[model samples]
Target chain A: MAKGPNVNWLPVKDDNRPVNLDLTKFHFPLPAITSILHRISGVLIFVGTAVLMWLLAESLSSEEGFQRVGEWLQSPIVKFIVWGILSGLLYHLIAGLRHLLMDAGIGETLEGGRRGAVLIIVFSVISILIAGVWVW
Target chain B: MVSRVSGATNLGRNGLHDWVLQRFSAIVLAIYTLGLLGWFAVNPDFSYGAWRGLFDATWMKIATLAAIIALCAHAWIGMWTIATDYLTSLALGKAATFVRLLFQAGCVILIFTYLVWGVQILWGL
Candidate 1:
């Protein structure tokens, strides 16, 4: 390792002049968008798992337990929550598959990543529609 | 690195496993979701015996079980990849590995619990 001072540890203001800091000039790229969405979907899955597990435990306890869960599903508010969870599951599944594909060297190129993002959107919409039908 | 032609397919390296598993799970979940919707549409009462009868069918039992298993496996693989990729520090990486092990174990327990429940319903246990 170099014995010189670490440039990365320096404050941004020390490294660059205030006049040069033009935030408006910067724009988010496609890859950044996709990456952000991936993290979002991951969080969604984490939250959804908690809710789904509760439903599973309740439904399996007894016949009345099953009925209670079934009744919750019938309510519009509960249905909305279920639909939201399903949507999260659906998007996370698709985006995750994309990341796996990328890791396997499938979508490493710029064009490939763009296409993968498009595919994610398409899959998400289709799954959401299915959830809508199931819920409503 | 020299690429040799051993010809034994590297399914994991080529992402075939991920692709196939993901789509396979998706298909299972799709069918399961649709069937559950139908159950609600046709028999909304959701009585004790009615719920039992639904899961008692050979196809429903198999399908639901399969869906649960596939969903868990698919989610496990996905989460493991994310945790490994992001947590860069060696210590954090090891922590993530431990977490992944817990995740896989938990998923197995989940599937086992569901299977036991389903069997008890079918076999009067």
Candidate 2:
């Protein structure tokens, strides 16, 4: 009988263990943090799309409709919403591009992924700032 | 049963397909977003007439439609993936899958409505 570690032939079973991970105490890596933020930004953009579609539909209806949207956008609250949505969009866009590049065999390594995450954060901040200035 | 296992594996394959389509749609959306933003940035005097004229071009209308479709596709896959990852039997038990399916259905309805609305707007009907 072969009694070596490499020679043991045991059937692997499905891991049905209960997950007890304490998310609050868990320390996520930078890349993981970026990934979670990407999901969140996606949700934000999803919700914001309704508001944008409404604005678009209204603006395209008539000249008065367009004026109404333009005036509404001038309000501080509306401007704030626009800024928030644009910020979410900008972050999501950058992170999404990172994911695409990863799929294309770029940033496939651990160090490369980390660098990409950092670049996404930096680019998103600058873009959001520009969007804020444009909206305000 | 072996058939059941194969069925589950097929679902996994479909997920891979969804992943590919999601990225493809994302690329389309990114291009459209950049172009639209650039147009707005250069045209400081954005009025109703300017907005109308921009969409008045056939190419612009087609591009906008394509972007709208891609946006819907991307959002559907994204939201579906999120729901599947977070909302599961381990989390919400029996209610989890039901809620996830409901949310997905709602997204589908919303996407369909947006597509119809987009077509109407683009064709000026």
Candidate 3:
């Protein structure tokens, strides 16, 4: 340890906080859970973006290519996958908007944060459902 | 030496710089997403001809290229944060740093590929 100059400080006490935490056992607050879901949706969007990119490319290749891409998307599994991606995207967008609001000092309080989280989840669910309808 | 000196990760270097980058990119990406959603709302049951025509426009092409670049920058910071948050020493023990580097490397490659492929798709003959 590096030596401190001038006045002497008191000795530090032993830290007893759990080092390896079991996340599932711990209860998280609404805002914390929303934050976690934001990350989760972000990661999901990351993978989905790649899939979307390919679809974009293939659809733009030719008229036949576009029709073929649409045909393959007729499968329920593919529709579900695309819906999942859209769901992730919708949730992520709403959550991200909340983050931007926080950045602008709009909803930085605890009460504000909780309300914001509820709003995020509610709006995201509504958007995701609408996306599901459109996709189907 | 610089990482040790500044206490910064080597991937994107500075925390504040990365924060600003992510914010700016986020705004661009958010607008692009909203724009696409609005287009879909307006163009229900849009045909291949309409879709191709939309992309064929110079302005839309420029907009897409800009969004692709923003996506790369935005995604890099997001993934880097995720890697550092979860793949740290507390979670992965001694090999966490190594694993993080590998993960970040993959993210960089994938993001860059997306940028190039997006350009190809946007402007390809």
Model 2, A50-112: lDDT tens per residue? 888888889988999999998998999999998999999999999998888898999899899
Candidate 1, after superposition: displacement of residue A108 in Å? 10
Clashing residue pairs for model 1: none
**Mind giving the per-residue lDDT tens digits that candidate 1 earns over A1-136?**
2233323323353443334223346587766666677666655665465577678657766877888898898899989988888787677667766776776799889899888888888888997897798778
Please estimate how well model 2 matches the true structure, expressed as its whole-model Cα lDDT: 0.82
Task: Determine which window of 10 residues in candidate 3 chain B has minimal summed lDDT.
Answer: B1-10
Candidate 1, residue B9: lDDT: 18
Candidate 3 regions exceeding 4 Å error are: A1-21, B1-13
Q: What is the lDDT of candidate 3?
A: 0.84
Indicate the DockQ of the complex predicted as candidate 3. Answer: 0.45
Question: After aligning candidate 1 to the native by TM-score, how far in Å is the CA of B40 from where it should be?
Answer: 4.4
Share of native C-alpha contacts between chains A and B (below 8 angstroms) recovered by candidate 3:
0.52
RMSD (Cα, Å) for all candidates, in order, is 8.7, 6.3, 5.6
Residues A43-94 of candidate 3 have per-residue lDDT tens digits of: 9998899999999999899999899889978889989999999999889889
Candidate 2 lDDT over B50-73, as tens digits, reads 898888899999999999999888
- List DockQ, one per candidate, in order: 0.11, 0.44, 0.45
